[model samples]
Target chain A: MSRFTKIALIGLILFPFAFLLMLSLGKQWPYPAIFPEQWSLSNWQLVLGGSEGLGNSVLVSVLLSLSVATLSTSLSFWVSRHIAYHPKREAWLSLAYFPYVFAPVILAACLQFFFIVAGLYGTFGGVLVAQLFITFPYGVIFFSSFWNERLRSMEELVKTLGGSTAQAYAKVLVPVAKGALMTCFFQLFLISWFEYGLTNLIGVGKVPTLTLRVFQYVSEANIFLAALASCLLILPPVALLWLNRAVVFREG
Target chain B: MLTIKNINKQYKGEAVLQGLSFTLRAHEMLSILGRSGSGKTTLLKVLAGLETADSGQLLLDGQDLSPVPANQRGVVYLYQEALLFPHLNVFENIAFGLRLRRRPETEIKEKVNGLLQRLELPGQARKMPEQLSGGQRQRVAFGRALIIEPRVLLLDEPFGALDAETRRSMQQLLKRVAKDFGLTAIFVTHDLKEAMLMGDRLGMMQNGQLKIYGNRAEFIADESTGALDEARFWTDLQGLKLTK
Candidate 1:
């Protein structure tokens, strides 16, 4: 990158983070000061200390996101392999994009009655299902490009070398696609982690993820706590992106 | 011995392989020369069991192999492009078949190391496929195919992507490896010189049918092969030089 471009890119990232940190730390800035008049860590402490299940909410968000990412990514890998070369694979891919393109809040509204009847509404599982309905398609779309004739040829090579189907997956397919799979996993995790509209509608204020907590604090007019929760909400993906840059992209 | 009889295949109403038939004795190489759409690859794929022939009998040592799946058929097809397993290093790629068979580590090591040496890639056992040159990748692929002691090895234009010097060296190495392993091999290429140089017996494929020649003289004598025309042109040019 050129010097000016590098500076601009860093500024674009750090500036928002700096603004969020300031908002989280400030008691009342009230503008025209260029800095907070009063700063405190009380909001941060309150969220971290687990008052009204804040810490529990964070844990729930992490668990749900990780589970969704793992299930969808792993499932997509196997599913894409099977359907990739099918004569109707393009038609199937078009169907996969449908769930992703729909408005999540609207989809949630339509699915809410089914969830309530199934005894899933106001439950953790309800939130998980709702989020998965949105995120799983992303996984499918992410992996669709990777399942090609070249990969199939690799599978064939494995078979001709006396390896079984299971052996081909274990030895060749997984190893060759490991990097791309990891990148997809992280992406799905980010999608699930930051999801809000569907989680709110499905959970009905019963399941408390970090995004929900942020919204709750905002509704209560606690700006500092809201900002603090928002920062926490965004941190994992940022860290993951940085880690991916360092590991996968750098080596590749 | 390996024999293919009445192998026929069609795709979308177009015949890719039309009653293609051939035979090869043990330790002999048959090179099939053809244009791109001449069904050479389709024939090879049929033998490897990657593609099932619409009608054919594949015989190996007098046993019918038509009912066999690809893995059990003991037929290895090397693609025109070097299809080295990208995740594996040179040694692992070569040892892939042996490891799949659950062979002892010591045996795998001895066999792979021997192949590495013989293929002239002695110091490259640890390099990833991406790190190797086109020639090296193809050699590793050859070793990977040969290590399993397959009944027949089908090579589909294996050296087509290499530079001239690399192609020549790979051809020589292929001949040497086939001899050392006693491999029943079918080499496919569009290059006349490559087909002539690699095969113990040479054949030509046109419109999904194969015509095998008993010798180089016979192959050259066939006007449709382009060899005779090429020879006449060279001869006429030589005469002009003599007159000058």
Candidate 2:
């Protein structure tokens, strides 16, 4: 590989371990160096292995991520397929994104407010409703091209071969779109997992996500603990990236 | 048998066909020849029930096929691209129609096997469309369209993707298959050589109508005239207004 690539490879390897070691060591820095003078799992325990029953936060994040990704991707799949064939498809797509692009946070607030007015307030269903629009746009963007160009041809071909539109989509379109679906799911999941402003703003303190816990810890001057929480927050995404390195290699 | 009479179409206030008409007998391989955007493919779409005509009537087997849906019309369309489903294997692609009707497993296997053999794709039954070469993919498309036993086949530049040799071979294959299966096919092309070689009778489309049509000798006779004559033929075929 080239020199730049080599340096990037080296940086990728060393950066994570260096930061994790420093954070675990708390304030015990070595003299005139970035290395910690002392290293221990005490802070790791103080933040990550805490007896605060963070299990709830973990469960909430994982569940919300999974549900949001699934809901958004599913919605976008059918909508994108139908809209892809529209005569003025690009124009209509631009219109669909209007709600998404213009003040998404504001739109989420309006949706949240509407949900409260409709008596869905403080409910799990209400939180999911708020996240649908938040996560929906990404899935639409991701799957729209696939449906229009790649999957559209495939579906039509299958249709000619005697498959119904629905069968064609379920059988051929979905399989060819597997890569896109995976990417959409991960991206949407990540969005829902890391969202602080919307989740905190809309849920109105009724529900707690991992991001809420992070900020809660951050304001108390527990910088190391907060960083540890951030690290913990980063793990699932990093693990997901590692698990699907195929997608990363392609994206890279 | 398929018959189109006085078929008229327009796009954005522009007329494509003005009283265009034709008759395609069973097992007759008829080719529609035209320059680009001469409404040849549009006519094929109208014949296949993919597009509606502004005015005129289409009769298939003496019944009005205008109201029929594309799939139910027994009108199979082959795009310039083979358009094979990327997710499906060769067998699945070829067996698409049978699968839709819920054909028996033994029959599907037997028919698809026959297709694989006929198309010289015997060992590629499990391979996806991406794995096949351009020629291989087109052959598979041909087999898939034929296996359905469509009453009328509409091809839109079906050999446009193939090399010269492959196109020649496919043209021959189509001729034999169209005769053997009694398929009334409306093949479209803009190439002079392709149109002559593929069709039993060729129709030259210009503007919105078939203007120059006949057997090989007739088209040749028209071609022997001056370039201006040929240009006039195109103009009359399309009903274009000239600056003269």
The candidate that achieves the highest TM-score relative to the unseen native structure: 1
Off by over 4 Å in 1: A1-12, A22-42
Cα lDDT, all candidates: 0.88, 0.77
What's the distance in Å from true for residue B111, model 2? 1.4
Off by over 4 Å in 2: A1-53, A96-112, A147-153, A223-228, A247-252, B211-217, B222-244
lDDT of 2 at B140: 90
- For model 2, what is the error of residue B185's alpha carbon versus the real structure, in angstroms, after optimal superposition? 0.8
Candidate 2: give the clashing pairs. A161-B97, B16-B208, B206-B238, B207-B238
Candidate 2 lDDT, B117-195, residue by residue in tens: 8777879999988898888899899888988888888899999989998888888877777777777888889877788
TM-scores of chain A in all candidate models: 0.92, 0.81
lDDT by residue for model 1 (A1-252), tens: 899999999999799888888899999877698887899988778777767577788889998998888888898888877768888988988888887566899999999899999999989988888888877778888889898888888888888778789999999998888888889989999989988899999988888899888889999998788888888888878888898777678658
Q: What is the DockQ of each candidate?
A: 0.72, 0.38
Q: Candidate 1: what lDDT? A: 0.88
